[model samples]
Target: MEKERREKEEREEKERREKEGREKKKGERARRKRNREWRKRERKKGERERKIKEKKRERKKGERERERRKRERRERRKKGEREDREKEERREKGEREERERRERERERKEKERCDEGERERDRERRKRERKRGERKKAEREREESEIGEREREKGERERKIKERKKGERERERRERERRKKKEERREKGEREERERRQRGERENGREREKQ
Candidate 1:
């Protein structure tokens, strides 16, 4: 009975040791699994934070680029305005010069007209002096002079007619050129307005895209 009890006690002790060893191994496996899960969670969180940080940096960079581009556009627009003003000033200067030249040309033409009138007066006085001679000789002289005068008058009339035609054609050409300039100005204005509208639409599209 003592030997049987001792054997039974020894078996119980061995069983208890084996059960404790198995529970310790199970606990180690659970700890390893929890460590792996914690490492995976930490890795995922780091990745998420890195991605969010990168995205924020990228967004900030994009905003800076956009602002820089906007500033450049504004500067370019200001430069264009300055250039336009310079061009306008140049055009006005050219117009003033043109007016001065036209006035000078008109004064020269008046002087020429006065000289021609004086020449005509001298010719008439010579004709009157010739009329004071003998009757038949005077009549012959008058006929020849009248014939010459008629030729001169015909040539003057033809010259005047040619001048009139040239003036009319020049007036017509100037009118056409003026009309073309006006049309070009109108077209340019329309194009500018259209470009503005297109830019507005593009801005709206970009806003919608961002949203």
Candidate 2:
């Protein structure tokens, strides 16, 4: 009887030890699962930090490029301003040169006009002198011709007076010869008549004696 009871107690003790070992193994498996889940969460956090850093670096590079482009634009504007200044200076010089040329041309034209006026005045004086000399010669010729005509008229009047005096003397001599002839004829006729009358008286006395 005592050996059976001791054997039964040992068997019961062996079964309790086997059940405790199974419980320890299940606890160990649960711990291993929790560790694995924690490691996965840590890996996700690290990946997110790396992406944020890369985005910040890209933004910085874009800002630097924009600054460089602005500087280039400012340098180009300065060069254009210098070129414009040079062009303005050249235009002013050209305008001054044109003004000087126009002034010189006007002066030359004035000088030419003055010289031509002087030449015309000299020619007018020469023509006036020639006309005065021609008028003097014509007046002298007219005076000589009038004097010769007066002398010719005086000689013709003297010749006509001499012819009239000779005609008057011839007419007086013819009248005196006719008067002497008429007086001689009248005296002869009177003597003949007186002789005839005496004869007739002698005849009358003879008749008375006869009766």
Candidate 3:
């Protein structure tokens, strides 16, 4: 009977130990499962953080690229403006030279007219000297008086005709100058319109880029 009791106690102790071992195994399994789940959650969080950081980096890089392009465009525009200014200066110099040439031509024309008048006076003096002689002088003087009167009438007619022609020519020249001015103004307006349109197009492109 004591042996039976000892055997029963041993069996019960063995069973309890086995059950404790199973419970310990279950606890270990639960701990491992919890650790795996925590690791998975951490991994997902880390992945999400990495993606956000990557997106931020990409955005920063893009911004930097955009800024670089903007700076380059600005530099190009400044160079173009400087070139245009130089061209304008050259054009002004050419115009000044042209005006000076026209003024010199006008002076030469006036000097030629004065020289022609002096030559006509010298011819008239030589003719008067040749006629200054003898008994024919009285008859020559009478004829001279008649010729001078006829010449005076002719000169008055020529002067009147010249004044009328000059008036007409002056009006024509004024009209031509006015027409040229109007044409130049129209061309300038067209160019200004084109520049404005180009500016507007550039503004639209910039807005689209921003969008």
Clashing pairs in 1: none
Give all TM-scores, in the order shown. Answer: 0.46, 0.36, 0.49
Top-TM-score structure, candidate number: 3
Candidates in order have lDDT scores of 0.72, 0.58, 0.71
Error of 2 at 196 (Å): 99
Report the lDDT of model 3 for residue 118: 69
Worst 10 residues of 1 by lDDT: 129-138
**Order of quality (TM-score):** 3, 1, 2
lDDT of 3 by residue, 1-211 (tens): 9999999999999999978866775687578669767976996698689769967986897688669757875786577568757865786597568757865775676567768776577557545644553235466556756875687578658856976787689669868976996798689769966986786588557656744
Candidate 1 deviant stretches above 4 angstroms:
1-3, 108-211
Error (Å) of candidate 2 at residue 210 is 99
Model 3 bad stretches (over 4 Å): 105-109, 112-211
Q: What is the lDDT of residue 26 in candidate 2?
A: 56
